[model samples]
Target: MSSPEQWTRPEPGAGPAATAAQPSPEQVIAGLRATAEGGAELTQLLTPEGERQPSRFDPYLADIDDAALRGLYRDMVLVRRADRECNAMQRQGQLGIWVPLLGQEAAQVGSGRALKPQDMAFPSYREHGVAYTRGVDFRELLGIFRCTDHSAWDFREHGFHPYTIVIGNQVLNATGYAMGQKFEGKVGNTDPDGKPSGTDEATIVYFGDGATSQGDVHEGFVWAAVYDAPVVFFCQNNQWAISEPTERQSRLPLYQRARGYGFPGIRVDGNDVLACLAVTRWALDECRHGNGPVLIEAFTYRMDAHTTTDDPTRYRLSDEIEVWKHKDPIERVRVHLARTGGADQEFFDQVQADADAFAAELRDYCFNMPDPPPERIFSEVYAEPSAALDAQREEYLAYLSGFADGGEQ
Candidate 1:
C-alpha cells in the first residue's frame, strides 16, 4: 500500500488518454499468476489435491495422529452437513434466517479443535462449525435461527459467548476476557520462565475480513497488544464482506495490519485444515506462554451467499465460485484419508451414514419445533421477573388473544 502523497491519479478530464495503456493479455495473465503466488506464501501443510506439504510449522502438526486427522475430517463433514440443513430450513421457512458457513468448514473445525477447555471463544454469528467442534449439538444451533432463544446454548458453560450479531464487538469482549485472565494471573502462572506451557488458558475470537475495518476490532488489537493479553484474533478472510469484496476494506493483506498494533501476524491457507490447525495451535501456545495477542488471517473463500436471504449471484461471478471448488477443504481431507490409508472405505461409509442420520434428525426437529409461547420471551430476559415485565407480558398476551383464531387483528 502507498500513501496518497506517493501515488497519484490521472486528471479527470484526460478520459481515454489517461488510460495507462491497457495491459496486454499476456501481462494480465502474468499479474494474476503473481497474485496467486503472493497468497500461496502463507504456511500451507496440505494441498487442495490431498497431498501433504512440509513447512517450518511442521512441528505443530506432531500430535495430529491418523485418528486425530480422521476426527478433523469428521468434524468438517458433520459441520458442513449441519450448515446445509440450516440453509435448507431457512429456505423452506422453518427458520427465520440462517448464516451458512458453507466453504469454511476446515478453517473453523481446525482452529476450534486447537483450544483447551479452559480457554474462551467469542464468535461472530456464523461460527456453527466452531460450536460443533466445541461439542455443542448441531440441533442447538437451529433454535436461535428458529427464533425461540437468544442463542442455542449457554455461553458461560461452554466458555463461548452468545453469537454477537453486532459486527466486531466480540473482539473487544475476547480481549477484555484475556486481560482479565492476565490480571488474575491466569496467564504465565504455569510458565514463570516464559517458556511454552499448556497450563495457561487463552482466548480465541473469530471475526471476518470486514471486521478488520471496524473500530472495535482495532481497539481490541490495541488493548491486547498493550496489555499482552492472551488472546488470538482469528480473522477468516473469506474474500468478501457481504457484497463488498475484501479489496475495498484494506489496501494490504489483512494479516499485515497486525504490524501496526505491534504484534506478529500470520496468514495460513484457510482451506487447508492441517495448516489452520498448526497455525492456531502455535498462536494459542504463544498466548499461554504470555507472548500472546496474535492475529491469524485465514485466507479462504465463502462459497455461499452471506446469508440465506442474500442473492450471491447479484454480486459475484459464477466463475469465481467454480475456481474455489477445486480448493474444497473437506474434499482434500477425504481424499488424503483414503489415498494415504488413514481411513478405509468402511470408515468413510460410517462417517457419511452418521452425517446423513444427524441431518435427518435435525430436519425432523426443525419441522416439528412448535412456536414458542409469547410469554416465554419475557421470562428469560431477567433472572428475577419484575412487576413491569410481568405486566407487559400479560398485556402482550391479552393483545394477542384479541385476534380471532386464524383471523387478522
Candidate 2:
C-alpha cells in the first residue's frame, strides 16, 4: 500500500515547480470528463477489449481458476438479467421503484465474492448483485421494491445488512460494526508474514460517488481511520449521482480522499471483474491483519438511469453512453472465457438459459406477491409486546373491520 504522503503530492506537472499549485483550466476540464480509463493509477487485470494483463495483485487471485472465472461470468449474466427484469417490472407498476445495477455487475460481484463467510457487508440500495453473491434470495429483495416488507432474509445469517436507502448512512453502521469486531478481538491475528492465521473478520461498506459528499461518509472515514477499524470503504464511482456528474462532487479523484483520513486508497478498473476481485481481496487481507480501513474507488459507469424514476439522458450525452457500451462488463468476461477456451458455446447457451429462468422466476414472484394487511406492520415493530402499541394495533384493526368488507368504508 502506498503511504498517505505519496497521495498528497501534486502530480508531476501540476505542482508549484510547474505552472501553478491549482490545476490549469484545461486540466480541470479534463478532470470533469468521465474517466472510463481510470488514468495510470487504475489497477486492471483485464482490458476492456478482453485481453488479460498481469499485476502485483495476481497472487490474490490464485484460487480463481478457469472454472471460477466462468462462474464469475455466469454470476454477472444472471445479475444483469435480474436487474433488467426488475426495471421492467417497475415500469409495469409491479414494483414501487427499482434501482438498476446494469453497468456495475463486475464491481459488485467481484468485491462481493471476495468476502469470507464471517465478513459483513453494508450496502446502498442498488446492490442487487452483491445480495446475490451473499446468498440472498432474489425473491426476498423483491419485497423491498414491492413495499411488502423491509427485507425478508435473515441479515445475520447472510452476513448482509438490509439495503440502506439513505446515501452514506451505511458507512457509519459498517464502521460501528467493524469497531465491534475489533473490540471482540475478531481482527489482527496474523502470521509473521502478515497473513491472517486465525479467526479474523472484516467489514465492507458500499456507497457511491454522490455519497462521498455526505457528512456521514466523512465521519465514518475519520472514526474508522482513528481507530484502525477493520472496514473497507468500497465506493463504486459510477460517474453520476443521478443526473449529476462525478466532477461536480470533487475536483480530485474519489479514492484520493482516503489519504487525508490516514489510510491507503486504490483505484481499480471496476468493469474488470478480475481486477476488482484481486484488489478487493488484497484490501480485505490488509484489514484482517490489522492494517485497516482501506478505501477502494471502483472506476465504472452507470449504463442506465440511476433508478427507475431517474433520467440519465437529461444530464449525460449519448456519445458518453455509447463509449461505455464498448466496455460492457459481462461482454468482456464472456469474450475472455471464449478466447481462453475456459467455456464453450454450449456453456454460454446454458448460462443464458439459466439467467432467463432466473429473471422469469423473479417476475413470477413479484406478480404473485401477496399484499400485507394493514395490521401486519405492527407485528414486527417490537420484540416484546407493548400495551400502547397493542392498543393502537387493535384500534387500527377495528377501524378496518368497520368498513363494508375490510376496506370499502
Clashes within 3 Å, all models in order: 0, 0
Candidate 1: residue 59 Cα off by (Å): 1.9
lDDT of 1 by residue, 1-409 (tens): 2222111232354222111444333333333232233264587888889999889888988898899999999988888888888888898889999998999998999999988888889999999988887777778778889888777687777878888999999999999999999888887765567565656789999999988889999899999999999999999988878976665455567899999999999999999999999999999988988896999999888999998889989966676678789989999999998889999999988998989888999999989977777778787888885999989988888888878862221
| Full-model lDDT for every candidate | 0.83, 0.88
Question: Could you tell me which residue pairs clash in candidate 1?
Answer: none
Worst 10 residues of 2 by lDDT: 1-10
lDDT, model 1, position 108: 96
Q: Please give the distance, in angstroms, between residue 124's alpha carbon in candidate 2 and its true position after superposition.
A: 0.7
Candidate 2: segments with Cα more than 4 A from true spot: 1-34, 190-195
Q: What's the residue-level lDDT of 146 in candidate 1?
A: 86
Across 309-333, the per-residue lDDT of candidate 2 in tens digits comes to: 8888787668777888998899998
